[model samples]
Target chain A: MNSITTPSYAVHFNQIAYTELNKHLSQSKYSKIFILVDENTHNYCLPTFLAQINEDYDFEIIEIEEGEVNKNIHTCTQVWEVLSELDADRKSAMINLGGGVVTDLGGFVASCFKRGIDFINVPTTLLSMVDASVGGKTGVDLGPLKNQIGVINQPQMVLIVPEFLKTLNERQLQSGFAEMLKHGLIRDAAYWESLKAVLDFENIADFIYTSVTIKNEVVLQDPTEQNLRKILNYGHTLGHAIESYFLESPKHDLLLHGEAISIGMILEGYLSFKLTGLPESELNDIKASFLARYKKTTFTKTDIDTILTLLKFDKKNSHGNVNFVLLKNIGECAIDIKVPEDLLKEAFEFYAE
Target chain B: MNSITTPSYAVHFNQIAYTELNKHLSQSKYSKIFILVDENTHNYCLPTFLAQINEDYDFEIIEIEEGEVNKNIHTCTQVWEVLSELDADRKSAMINLGGGVVTDLGGFVASCFKRGIDFINVPTTLLSMVDASVGGKTGVDLGPLKNQIGVINQPQMVLIVPEFLKTLNERQLQSGFAEMLKHGLIRDAAYWESLKAVLDFENIADFIYTSVTIKNEVVLQDPTEQNLRKILNYGHTLGHAIESYFLESPKHDLLLHGEAISIGMILEGYLSFKLTGLPESELNDIKASFLARYKKTTFTKTDIDTILTLLKFDKKNSHGNVNFVLLKNIGECAIDIKVPEDLLKEAFEFYAE
Candidate 1:
């Protein structure tokens, strides 16, 4: 049983699992409850969620198509209209019960519905539980761009349940592991070492808890992303560009956010070795760990050029400069480091290897 | 030269005028500049604005179609794509240079672009200068619903130039006057009487300044609209429903926001007289002032039923209750006041007179 509070909201672990959720709901006395889920979560997670909560409060289930492509303004409009049609008032609470797609879109829809409404995240995927659901960054993509339209609005609460992770496939689980690895790389060496030592799902709950705590701590310190919060975006700059690139390319398979970021970490690690003087041994360790888990992705000369161009659109960029967060050491990262084009090409070469 | 700062941003009247805007722009040193204008403003107001700002900065003009219909997600997508195609970075600054449609959509686009960016509102309409530009509420309409999907993010600055009002037609001018009169009715009896006494466009600048000040004061007190801010929505609850109803109905002409709210104020005045014991004479005075300026609108029995049904969708509602902000007196309002259906019908009858 553990609880952590950010400036805007709170995250509760096993202590306030199901019974606590019912109690919180009863005490809050919301007018009605609406649960937002994509097809996958509606099929897999909703039944388990229903079984846990004993309260007979009035609630409705809203299902959207699952996947990254569905995370757009059209979907948002549909959800908003549905909420309005259902007569969801300001006092009504929404529970987002799915992965990143559901939580991100639902959080945004809730935030803008009638200016805003109370929403809680009950993440049903490893990727979302460890990463997306913890932070207040909720939004959908604009065209092929990633999170181009959104606001930094926190949810009322985030409930993390490990039982929901039973539904994730191996790739989905690995996708989430990338962020956990990121938490260790950016802040804690021992945590990184511990995560690397155990790649199995035996203590997945412990891993999620630690990841959540690390992300929550960083976000709490810098909710507005003035300085410290940018550190949380260590792999995100290049990672996001790559994610958007592949998501838009008709020929390439869509890369899960974590998968793209994993490649970004490897490329950034190489850049770190070249520019930031990160030890070659640590860089090798990083490369080996990522390559072993994530399938190697190849980019052509044209693809590289496109990715470079896309980097300018990264929200982190200011004054058209593509800033990178490179690892100074395995556990320490430096921000706003500008890397040379030649070194970026070499980093891509290293990732391809 | 008067400047008032809200918790979110600042409103500069005459002091931080065009010259100050030029200096502010130079000091900020943004990556790029963009001006969002509707066709009307582009044709009429852009020349005046360009002439005042002597400094030449790298800027582009992005124009959308004029009127309320264009304030939708599709328009937002087009503007976002244009910004993307033009490579507008996080440091880019957007100047919303039109009436409420341009400012509302542009503010929302800028807020969500790259998570958020710096934007300044240069309101070109009386309604916008006094009301829309002051509050941080920015969004496009969802279907016939007004401001259904939006956020409460303020601009970096609001620059109000009354010179833009010279281009407005009499109906448009009167539309804005409705809100000014509302400012007086809800908060300042003296202000209300002053507005009633002078219905002509002469001394319109003083009226605009006073209305902006009053609205800013109320918004500053409650940015989140939890308590004090709800008072500002006094006429909006029913007014919004009526506006949305007419906008959707093929039989009726689109009512200007101020026009719809004027009728709402009269209806609410009747409710206030019945439920809150607002003086019969004051209610009569309120009705007379509104009818003198705005042409009386007639609502059939079906229209009233439809408008009443639409009340449930008002953003102000909670727990299915059509909560309203009713006038307790000419100078004060009580929020979250629920009026019975019978009383609502009577209020409509009072408006018909």
Candidate 2:
């Protein structure tokens, strides 16, 4: 497949990814190469990743625990100290070879280690490849808050080897599919329609490539998420709050990022219908598409209130207002709209239905 | 005094500093204003800083404990949680009002909080004003390693108020003077000659301004320290190792940053004479000037060996080689020169003299 160009770096796919990666490794005078992986990727993905690197430089694998709970500064500190202990210098390059947690935390680790070092993202999960792969956003969660501490530092390159998706289970694959579904909802209705069909995990390369293209286009226009980029947060406002709530609550089962956001897209879709002139027919389509793939999640009134409280901490919020990107249509979004509290509760009811 | 313009921001001095700052505050629609200080600054500098901000905004003070020992990632985590808990959003602006610890740590905090927010540096200490003010080098140290974790992100502006210098003692003033002397040693003999005279702490504004200009010029030429910027690290290689050694060791009196680097300049001066052809007469001149201001200290063979081990962790090291910036003459220098382990021990002996 063809490589997608971002302002600072490129995303190369499949067989071409290895070529580009090896070329970059051989050309840059990296003192040492440190591959960052989590427990899952270290066992399942590292072997396949190791075979592709043609460089003769010294390679070291730095592994951390998997999951969002482990994605915090404390983990970053451990990785940083490890990098320091192993004598990783500014000239040393890091390859983040796992899901979002590893890539996000590792990118932050490299960016702040000795005031920034070069890193490449070899995203191992479907969710990471589609969403985290493009944007220069690299950060870890702060307590219950997600991506609260990070910088908008770009990587040297991103290698998306779809074959790595073989390591993911059905639920994990569906988690990444949610973002691909979002790309169609926010910017491309036709793409959204195509994504509703039952997807073969073996043939997901094209969909992943297209999803990245949509995200990259939005990110390129507003790299810092100033105005135009707010559209990308269509489902994320409530999605993130829900994600944080599930992540922290001992009583609830942990929701995968995509799973929570899938619920978010439905809730926000209802908000769009009421507030942003999103047609009721389009809202029904969005709701149906997500619910088919994701199991319907019911939030208690108390759970709804707690999740609403978390919205104030959203990064996109400005001047004490929780801003939402509601859709005017399936392929179009209205940025920075505030919905009333009662309406937010109503949207939760719509999702519960 | 005229405002000095950096590529991205300006260094406004004295009355103009307040005017520029107030103007920035009034003009930008920051959601809230956060002033970060240490315990010392919160008590000593905050009231003075608060009186100067003529804008009406909801102000929040986030104070950390004072000292170089507290400049670490753990401290940063605490500050990050505080910002989050306080509802510091992307639109919120932070004013770092204190010495290098506050400015460096606060800048890192602001830079990473919600993927960076606008921050201004109000450096209080002489060392911070001369060294940390203009470089955009913001970070916290990692376990015994000085500035091992940081990013080269500039603040919105730097407000250099000479009046704040009155808060420092003689040792602190001498500590800042070391960097000013370094400016002259690496780039300007004329400036070096001018700085050799006994300076009045009360009348050091012009000297501070010139020092910033000298440092800014080097940074602008090579912002990322790719080549020409390496010249700025002339005394820092050995200086940082010495600083880290003194910082971590309980047996030694805590050496101020400038105090340790001043010793570094003298030690590197000897190495320069041996390896880089720094004239013996000039080397003696460098030695006499620093010795008159700083107390001479003796290091045992074992202490020297421990410091040598710390050199491997210096940010400037690349490809397992410890690089030093050595002076070829009073105003000229060589960069990336490797000193033999034996020569390093000899330089410590030279300092002992």
Candidate 3:
């Protein structure tokens, strides 16, 4: 498959393409290489990574504790201290060798270290391969607010090798699938319908690649989220709020990003039907398809009110108004749509139905 | 004077220019405004700033504890939390209202806030107005390391109002003067000679403005420090090491940035004479002028060894080689020159003499 390009970087998708990574490394001639990983990937993925790279390169491994909770400045400080202690310099290149938490934190760390060093994302999870790959958005969550602190900086390259997906649990796989579904719902109705047929994990690389291309095309036209790129946030605004809400409430289980976003897409589908005239039948189809895959998540009345309040804190919002990305039709979206409170309530009711 | 433009953002220099700031505030139409300050600026600069603005603005003040030691991830978290709690949105503009520490941390915070928001710098110190005004460098020190964690991000505008300098102590004024002297040595010989004639604070705005222009021109040519931009680091290489050294060592008082760099320029001048064949007379002249202004700093043999070791940690370095930017002569310098250990020792001896 051909490589996808963002304004500042490229995304290369190959199945087990260690040679491609090696070739790029030789050409760049980095002073040293450092791989950032979480405990899980360090244990499961490092052996394969070491075996595949057929070059004598000076490299070291920096590991952080696993999971999204560890994705904060505390971990960043630890990693930075390690890099300093190990004497990493401006010419050093960091290979982010894990899932979204690893890549996101590593990308941010590298971008700020010496005003940025070269970083290549070797995404180990499906969510990162498609979602995090194209968007040059690198950041960490602040106090349960997802991605509140970060910079829009592109990595040197993104190397996607599908074999790493073999280790992901079922929940992780499904979480990644939600983003692929988002790509389809926002840009390609045909892609969305085809994705509905995907029940198993067999032959998912092509789908992931397609989702990345869709996102890349959108980002190329609007890198700064001024207009077209906002379409990519169709499910994200509400989804992110819901994700944060659950993460903060001890009573609720933490919603994997994809799971919360799955709910968000359904609610926004209903909003699209009411506000943007997205066909009612298509809205039902969208909800039904998502509900079929992601187990239904129930939000209490108070939870609904809290989520609504959280919407004001959404980065997309301005002047205390929540601006949403709503679909005009499947595969077509509108940016900066102001949904009324009654309509938002109705949309949630529709999701419950 | 007219605004100076870099590839990204503008620097506006005016004396008590509330009208210009009001005009910019109205034109920007930010959802709200927030001013970031330290205790000193809040006490001294804020009232003057409030009295000057002609237009009404819906703004609030957020104050952090003063000093370079406070520039850390902890402060960033606090500010981010405050911004979140206060409901500062993506469209809100942040005014960094103080010296280098405030501008540096505020710039980084704003840049990372929601992937970035617009920020305007109101530099209250001479060090910031001339030096920090141009370069998009924003960061805080990591564990006594200067600017160890930061991103190269420009503010929406840099508003340089010279009246703020009135409140600065003599030491603060001298510290800032060191950078101005550097501006002359690295690029403009005539400017250097003109600055030497300056013994009073009256009519220093032109000198500050000239230094800003020289730095801006260099930055416009090379924002990434790929080659030409490294010229700006002429004194910064050894200077940073020395700054970090004193900041960490219990035996020595902390050296202000400009004081450390003053020493660095003399040492590098001596190295230039040895390695780059800079004229002996010119080197002596450089040393004499710096010594006349900055109090002499003495380093023991152990201090020299430690500073040399710290050089490897300099962000400008690559592959364990300490690259020095040496002067070919006044107003001219060379980048990436590797000085041998013996010469580095000799340069220190020359400084000690």
Q: Pick the candidate with the highest TM-score.
A: 2
Q: Write the per-residue lDDT of candidate 1 for residues A189-211, one digit (tens) a residue.
A: 99999999876775688888888
**lDDT tens digits, residues B231-274, model 2?**
88877888899989988888999999888889999999999999
Among all windows of ten consecutive residues in candidate 1 chain A, which has the lowest summed lDDT? Answer: A11-20
Query: If both were scored by TM-score, which would come out higher, candidate 1 or candidate 2?
Result: 2
Please tell me which model should have the higher lDDT, number 1 or number 2. Answer: 2
The models' CA-based lDDT, in order, is 0.87, 0.91, 0.89
Pairs with steric clashes in candidate 2: none
TM-score of 2: 0.99
Q: Lowest summed lDDT over 10 consecutive residues: which window, candidate 3 chain A?
A: A11-20
Clashes of 1: 0
- What tens-digit string does per-residue lDDT give for candidate 2 at A5-56? 9988999998999999888888898999999998899999999988987866
lDDT of 3 by residue, A52-169 (tens): 8878899899999988888888899898999988889999999999999999999999999977889999999999998999888999988878888889898888988888999899
Tens digits of lDDT, candidate 1, B1-353:
47767776777775467866887898999999999998889999999988888788988999999998889989998999999888888889999999989999999899888778899999988899898867799988888778987888889888888888888999998888888889998999998888898847856877787888899889878878889888888788889999999988999999999999999999999988988879999999999999999999989999999999888877778888888888888999888788899999988988876
Clash pairs detected, candidate 3: none
Model 2: per-residue Cα lDDT at residue B133: 89
TM-score of each: 0.97, 0.99, 0.97
Q: Which ten residues in a row have the lowest lDDT in candidate 3 chain B?
A: B12-21
